[model samples]
Target chain A: MNVAVIGLGLIGGSLLQALEAAGHAVTGYDADPATRELAEKDGRNVAGSVAEAAAGAEIVALAVPLPVLPGVIAELAGYDGLITDVTSVKGPVRALGIRRFVGGHPMAGKETSGYAAADPALFDGCAWVLCLEPGETDLDDWLTAAALFTALGARVVPATAAEHDRAVAEISHVPHLLAAALARRLVGNPLAAALGAGSFRDGTRVAGTRAELIAAMCGGNATATREVLTAVIDDLRQRLDELSAADPVEALIPALREAGDARRAWPPKPGAAAEEPAGAEELLALGRAGGWVTAVSESRVTVRTMRPESDRITP
Target chain B: MNVAVIGLGLIGGSLLQALEAAGHAVTGYDADPATRELAEKDGRNVAGSVAEAAAGAEIVALAVPLPVLPGVIAELAGYDGLITDVTSVKGPVRALGIRRFVGGHPMAGKETSGYAAADPALFDGCAWVLCLEPGETDLDDWLTAAALFTALGARVVPATAAEHDRAVAEISHVPHLLAAALARRLVGNPLAAALGAGSFRDGTRVAGTRAELIAAMCGGNATATREVLTAVIDDLRQRLDELSAADPVEALIPALREAGDARRAWPPKPGAAAEEPAGAEELLALGRAGGWVTAVSESRVTVRTMRPESDRITP
Candidate 1:
């Protein structure tokens, strides 16, 4: 298979490497001649121009930024074979007038940006969003595009453009915004540098992402991302109100326990809470009560609060 | 040095293993004898009761939950050389009132909970917040306690209890709440379930944390957590209103761009604005010039609109 990858930076360049390792002929393109020259030196066929890259290629993989997508599509509209894009969001990308443009979002990235940070295993086992709309033309072409990325170890799942956007709105876009917002609050705060520990680093590690690219993503998906941000913020506000009126150490155990329980039951199970971590709650309640009724859930009353201040408190 | 770890859970168990691996004589206590028995069977530590574990030990580390902390401290208040506790938050644990107690908040943990998931490299290079107040206590004693954990490959940064909590409020607790709220939205949404690709999984990944624990953390750091959450909710609400009313493709880009720029500049160098992205205003100007900017930042702009949007409109 001949694969033509546009935007030979990180994602596109990595695809070129992976395709070559698989013994397929891989050609790449970029607007920057320097990037093209470097990629050529890296042993991939770096096209002199976008059109040259598309010449005689069986699969044209558009790995350009989301904002530049529509234009990239126009350039590829004349291509005769399968066409796909590795844009993080699919809705806007699919809106472009092009057939066989299978929308793809590879759900993996790293703190390290640029072609230098490209890795062959970047998309391994990662779910790749593949969208084909109802009015789309050439289904066989779409399948051919999907097959190429699938062979590269992506779990290619089919969806509509709307589904793809909304999914990312909830997960990718919203989370990225929150990470940015949270990171923004800390960047200049005196405690930021010293206090920015692992959890902070991991939570906003993606902050190292190309600022321009991410900014456009949030804006591009703003319509879909609006509700996600609102819902999250509302929940956060309510929780903040509930928690802040109290002290962290005095009130934290139960919250942490709840978070721990929720985390334990996630992804691995996909459904169902892991046996309600009854022990931690019980120990917490008992510890809170000092051998009496400490707290009660909606369904059950538990005793063990020893402090008079905590006496008669609902569990 | 002989070390006594008072709880045989994830953090404690791993510490016991690490201490022994480093050739330190380690004694362990888990009020639950079963845990102690397992520690023995696994050759992780010498099996002993709480009192037995502390006997003849130069260091006694309390790895128990905070609610039960006071009792544990009271149980071994007099026996100690540089006592420390591995609680996530420092305020309440410091109130445990041990004479030589030094506070530790290890900035590392797994999505998985408990000893079974404990990793030897858990604390490697991670920032371990050491909260020591002007308690009229000896600094060397607390520093001695810090040295033990530091030996295991942690960067120990000294902080007051209040500083530690505030820092965590911005980075740790707030992020956890955001993850939780995002995950909660998925509770009944079947669309989210089906559309949950890698981005969703990554966004809500930590949302799977234990619920009660998170609840407790919120409760514990209630005030600071509330402050951060309020700011987050307010900012998000404004963003929501803007995007809800405009084309996500247009209206949302500027806000996200600015935010994404600020987020990316974390742990900034002096005059970081030289690295600053194009602000929204600049991007707006650029967009007005037919560039069709998707995101605008302080010094950067992501031109999402294709060049032909002009041709399409004019023709």
Candidate 2:
């Protein structure tokens, strides 16, 4: 397989390294001259420009930041190869209507960024989401992309752009906003800041992320993020109302128990073995059911379903 | 100094060990016979009853759960010793009107509880809050408790019952509720659960805590927790509204930056040398300013104030 990864930042550089290490012929390109120079100096196949990278490549992965994505996508207009992206948000990219493009977002990252911090093992054992846009995405191209990520030891999750966006909004984008909001409350409250222990530290950890990056991710998925955030606000408001009740503690116990049960039951144990997905709908259904694709072929798709235990959170 | 620690749970047991390790004659007691046997078997001086532990002790520390606190306090009714508590919520305990009682809450804990998980060094470098009720607290007794915790390598922060409750609500109780709410959202959304990474994991870490414990902490500090949680909900609501705006990304940046600044500025660095607190009023002021007592004596109280450096979260 011939691969081209553009915008040689952490994800791009890592993909280039991982794909190359997986015996794929890889070429990488970055907008910054110094990054290209560094990759070239590191014995990587460094392309001078987007055209140079995409030329003669069977697959092109645009790993540029969200703001630069439209321009990069525009530059790949005439290219006939399979296209994918590593952006956190997928809805907007999917709306671009690019042929042979399967929007992707790997659920993996580090606190640090840039080519210097790239590691080939970054996506290992991580969920690499491939947006299987109904009626749009080419099955062959999607499978090729899934196979590439699977080869790098990633679990490929088949989802539509809308599903991907909503899921991430619930899991990633809204969590960032909530963290920021929680951290913001600490302002002018030095005592509270001082008293912050494990809960505050962990809850607000993502608030320490780069502001611009968080803004891009959350803001880009505005609709889904807003919906989820509103729901959270409503849930909290209900809890607040309960706090005013005659017996607030008693009123909160059931909700807390439910949450505790859900939390403790997370990352559900893997089921017996990989089962063949009937079709694309089944593949997407499996993903929504907390299952991941282990292998994809011309004839069948294999996935491991998560089995949630009933008595997991109970004492 | 002779100390009697009532309750042999994690905090109580750890306090017993830490105090004994600091060369204090510490005797421990618990309501559970099994816990008493375990403590006695572990070579700790375990008292069969609260009265036995309280007898011949100059300082009595109530390290019991919130529900058992009133009964424990009732048992110590006419004892003329310096009484202190390690309950998370101080307002209710302060309202108990126990003479010679000083409300205290140590901002340190482990995920696991019980006597078996006790560690002598648990309070090392942790903030041990000592409530100084403006008109009710005895200066000598307050100083004695402060000195004891200071000797255990804990930073003693002088706070009022209300102040401690509010601070913990902002930093601890409310965060617990938020984590629970976040975790609760994943109840049926397995895809979101599958996509959950560091942010979700960290944000929901405390949700995995004992539900009853969380309920007690949040509920015991109901008023303060509700206020803080309401504020958080409002902030999130405003962010949600911003997401509906034309330039949601631009609208959200300033707030995110502020939060990022606050989060990064956390835990402001320790200020200059330990300055002498003027009086009880000054000591309370230092605690509110995020300063902790390094030493306490008949003449002076030495504290190290946190110095938040400028340009911390800024690039």
Candidates in order, interface RMSD in Å: 10.0, 0.9
Per-residue CA lDDT of candidate 2, range A98-203, in tens? Answer: 7788899998888788999999999998899999866778777787888789879898888999888998988889889989998998888877877887788889
On residues B122-190, what C-alpha lDDT tens digit does candidate 1 reach at each position? 877666666656644455555465557667876555566776787788877777777666666555343
Interface RMSD computed for candidate 1 is what?
10.0
- Show model 2 residue runs off by greater than 4 Å: A42-49, A275-278, A298-315, B21-27, B37-49, B300-315
lDDT for every model? 0.63, 0.84
Q: Any residue pairs clashing in model 2, and if so which?
A: none
For residues B23-122, write the lDDT of model 2, one tens digit per residue.
9999999999999999999998988888889999999999987788888877887678999989888888888888888788888888789999999999
Residue B27 deviation, candidate 2, in Å?
4.2
TM-scores for candidates 1 onward, in order: 0.58, 0.91
Worst 10 contiguous positions by lDDT, candidate 1 chain B = B270-279
Residue A188 of model 2: what lDDT? 80
